[model samples]
Target: MNVTITTIYDELRGFLDDHQVSTNETILEQHSKDESYHTPSLPDIVVFPETPEQVSAIVKVADKYNTPIVPFGIGSSLEGHVIPYDKGISIDFSLMNKVLEVREKDFLVKVQPGVTRNQLNKELKKYGLFFTVDPGADATLGGMAATNASGTTSVKYGVMRDQVRNLEVVLPDGEIMHTGNLAQKSSSGYNLNSLIVGSEGTLGCITELTLRVYGIPEHIAAARAAFPTVDDAVEAVVSILQAGIPIARVELVDEHSITQVNRFSETDYKEKPTLFLEFHGNEQGLNHDIEFTKEIVEDHGCKEVHFEEDNAARNKLWEARHNLAYAYMHLNPGKKHMVTDVCVPITELAGAIKFARKRIEELGLLGGILGHVGDGNYHTSLMIDMDDPEEMKRAAQFNEEIVEYALERGGTCTGEHGVGIGKMKYQQREHGKAFSVMEKIKLALDPNEIMNPNKLVHSKRRSL
Candidate 1:
């Protein structure tokens, strides 16, 4: 480390304890990579901040030294969002994990950034409320909000940007700011909340957040329907959405994914193209919804349909779906995970998925296709040996192909995974001239380009 960098690290100890500030090789190595296929780069130091003030103080020190700062959560992010490429200080948030408040009467909850989705849900259960945005990773809320993540239930509840009511962030210059207020309705000055939510930590470090929650549904019914083909299953989902049935959760799992799930989970799910679905409402209304869903599936030549109302069975069904990616990793040992997701119009979802699958097959790679088809977002989870240049080349090509197809159909390159290093190359193509505006905003918030630099938006002074 240089003299200035050494001085900053030594001064950071004033704000936090020795144990909270780590220069250990192991900790720096751990902060170097996320769950994605991106190569790792070690940081010089890792600082655990217990409060927003501590974060701001740390940022001030880093800014003074002209050093980069990457926010670290649980490291569950799949897009290399937490990787510190500049080899500076990593501001770790794991110590700030606390459910600060539960405003059950107003369906709002305030939490520190490091709290995981599962942890918040466990606390919300007492109030008969639940946080709906589950990216299926038990990810820290800060990481989820940073990526604007969504999962199966997003079709009904909305994505991270929608659920977030407010955020407490530490600006790059060591200033604490709140993006919004407690009141939900605001024709306010500027929508800073939305901007900061998905900036992937390029804008600022999220310290705390107040998010909208939902009451536990009166009734939740889960089901699995096997279709004769992948296209048939996807088309059935489209028909269901068109019919306006409020599905709480609707996920599509291709035959390959099913095979992996069955192999890993040791459950005999039919190894066919299938839709795992759920509904939330009163008993009578939920039954009606289920009947309509069945009719739609049957119309698409569904081979068989099964429903699960029991709590254990229903939880197990969703659990298996959440674990689908892990099953792929289990099946392909000694391989890195390169999962990518894109969202297209509901009308084009079936074709988009078909195109993605075809590309995956032509490349002769082991890949599994699945998605939350209700809102037209899907993922292709691929396992690749990083040492194999050919495999890596094909994976990149497949991602580009799918993203291009989705963009042509009025879709986005990334559904929930933010524009970290993984999706950075597509921002210009996806946003066109408007990306320049984003660059301006990034420059304004982080003039030094210290907060997760080289992420969603590059420093204005830096060329592409």
Candidate 2:
């Protein structure tokens, strides 16, 4: 152990219990990596801080020592956002998980950053409220906010940044600040809440969040529509939106993904490019929307369409879609998963997916194309044999091609995964001159570059 880290470890015990601080190999290894395919590096120490005060003290110590600080959540992030590449102090937030408040009438909830989406939902159910911004994974709200994640319902409810009302962040120098307040609208000076929510811990550590929630839908319906081709399915979605159908969720599952879903879920769904859709409204309005949706899909050559009216059936259908990544992992044993998260304008969605599918076939790689097409975001789920140099190279090439296509057509390199090293290379091209502004902001907020170094933005001071 290095002298500096060893001293910091000893000093941390003064503020936390002996068991709260850990140097054991198992704990270090757990905090080293997330769900990404990126290589993992162990942090020098892992600390469990129960309160924001302890978090501030830990950051103060790290700042004094010029040590890198990486916040660890549940490690469910897909873009390596939680990996401690600099090997310093890993602050695990599991010990601080708690739903601090629920203002049911105001439709706002205050929660510690460590609380998971499902965990919060369970609590919100008591008041007939639910948090939106689900990123498929039961990711910690902090990690979701860090990545600015969004998923199926994003077309209707918006992304993580939209749901976030306020954030209690601990800055790099251990000073705590609140980025926003509970008011519904604000013309306030700077929207720091938006800035910190998707910083990926580069700017600060999110200790608490005040988020907006919604009442449970009065009428919910899930429907699956099979199409002859990917283009047809996507066209249907665009048409639905244009027709003013307020879709709660509309996901596109290509034939490859459908096959995986069938095998993994033990269902007899047709192996065709399909659209999984949902609607929320009063019973009469929802019925009309469903009928209109069927007509629109039929106009675009939909082969068959069916709806799930009950909660159990709807949940099961969505569960299958959410588990699609796991299905690929399960089928491709001994392989690592890397998903491309490029989002484009609604008009460019079909061409982008077509381009990605062609590249996957040209590279002779096994991958599936699927996404929340309702919001013009999709992913190419790739499974790679990391040991094979040729396979790794091809996978890298595919990702680069997909990202390039997205960037060329006015799309983002990363829609929700955050920069997280995987999409770091495309930042300059995607943001152009604005990329410099991001770097300046990072430096201004974290001059020492101790907050999750080597992520989202480049650091001027930190070499590693």
- The candidate scoring highest on lDDT is 2
Off by over 4 Å in 2: 461-464
What's model 1's overall lDDT? 0.90
How many backbone overlaps does candidate 2 show? 0
Distance from true location, Cα of 349 in model 1, Å:
1.1
Query: Clash totals for all models, in order?
Result: 0, 0
Scored against the true structure, residue 82 in model 1 reaches a CA lDDT of 88
Supply the TM-score for candidate 1.
Answer: 0.98
lDDT of 2 by residue, 274-335 (tens): 99999998999999999999999999999799999999999999999999999999999999
Least accurate 10 contiguous residues by lDDT in model 1: 455-464
Tens-digit lDDT string for candidate 1 (343-396): 998889889888888898999888889998888899999999899999899899
Off by over 4 Å in 1: 460-464
User: Please, what is the TM-score per model?
Assistant: 0.98, 0.99
Best by TM-score: 2
